[model samples]
Target: MHSHPDDKSLRDLLREQWTVAPVRNPGFRAEVWARIEAARRTPATWGAWLRLHLLGVSMVAAASIVFAGAGGGLLAGARDRHEREQLVQRYLISIDPHQSSAGEGAP
Candidate 1:
């Protein structure tokens, strides 16, 4: 890399910036305290509460939805399994006359 004759080195430039102090605002502290007091005085609102507990609320809603879907799927699977069993029993009965007579007598 090439350097300009007038340009200061990176280290020197950083040192110069680091030594310079920031200007202080006279009313900065009082303004911050006033805002804090105002916030404290205000009543808690629904929107603020929701914002504060947004992550928790969303997690609960998602969990409820997942549970509802899983329950529905389980019920559907059970009903389908029961229907398939009935279908298989009917098919077996239709194919054998002796088994059909025995099943009817036993039931």
Candidate 2:
């Protein structure tokens, strides 16, 4: 049992708070339902949709970009390989006239 000078006042304040009734707003429930209905009626915008699925959409876009870059690199590599092979064949034919005539006769 500790006694302080302010303890009694504190007890009285707590008692008053405990006995006080909370004020209720009658329109609160109706207002909440109205807001819910309004939200339901409104169509979602593209910005809102993007925000909701931002993670999935970003992953898909990144994958598409990566695949496109890889495909482009593969195509460029194939083209370079074909050109190099053709250049080697032309060099060989220039040095060997008989080889060029044999290649022309073959399919």
Candidate 3:
């Protein structure tokens, strides 16, 4: 809780302390802007950018390939399991038309 005698005097003091003086050198702004403009015009070439990040890109590609192989293997295993289940069902149906699936003796 500030108990300032007046708001105008306090605001004036703050402005005097915190305000940034303009650059006296007229060419300073122009020099900075020229460098920024030059950077934008040339830009980083794709070849140079890719060269800098080649390791990361290669790692991502390898991970993708590994995940694809793992997914394919999982699908193959599931398919084999389903086929085996179907074969077992067929065998049971053929062997036991009257045989209870619960191993109960048919009357």
Candidate 4:
């Protein structure tokens, strides 16, 4: 038989309620608010933000364009057709011995 009780678990200890005290210093809030206001008023900060946003939008647009182009079978069909034409031309050229001979009427 167990002589000692089981140890109180962390969960049991955390189950008790706790009170949190507010920050005593008011200057921290005031300084933070001032910085927020400064950021809002700064044209340079706003411009940088806008530029970053535009760059992100441009990247998304470019990726979407590439996806749409490839997904629509445009590039694939064109590449296949080009390859087929190249193969046909190669076959034609290979069969034509006169075309490969250097200097006309040599052999």
- Per-residue lDDT over 29-107 for candidate 3, one digit per residue giving the tens place of the 0 to 100 score: 8999999998876638888767878999989999999999999999999999878776766677789765346534322
Candidate 4 versus the native: TM-score? 0.31
**Backbone atom clashes (below 3 Å) for every candidate:** 0, 0, 0, 0
Which of candidates 3 and 4 reaches a greater lDDT?
Answer: 3
Colliding pairs, model 3: none
Best by lDDT: 2
Residue lDDT tens for model 1, 9-81: 8668877777866898999999999999999966599888788789999999999999999999999999998
Question: When superposed on Cα atoms, how far off is each prediction in RMSD?
Answer: 10.8, 12.7, 8.8, 11.4
| TM-score top scorer | 2
lDDT: which is higher, 1 or 2?
A: 2
Q: For residue 39, what is the lDDT in candidate 1?
A: 92
- State in Å the error of residue 93, model 1: 1.4
lDDT of 4 at 53: 85
| Candidate 1 ranges with C-alpha deviation above 4 Å | 1-48, 100-107
Worst 10 residues of 1 by lDDT: 98-107
Q: Positional deviation of 7 in candidate 2, in angstroms?
A: 92
Off by over 4 Å in 2: 1-43, 101-107
Off by over 4 Å in 4: 1-21, 25-27, 38-52, 74-107
lDDT (Cα atoms) of all candidates against the true structure: 0.83, 0.84, 0.80, 0.71
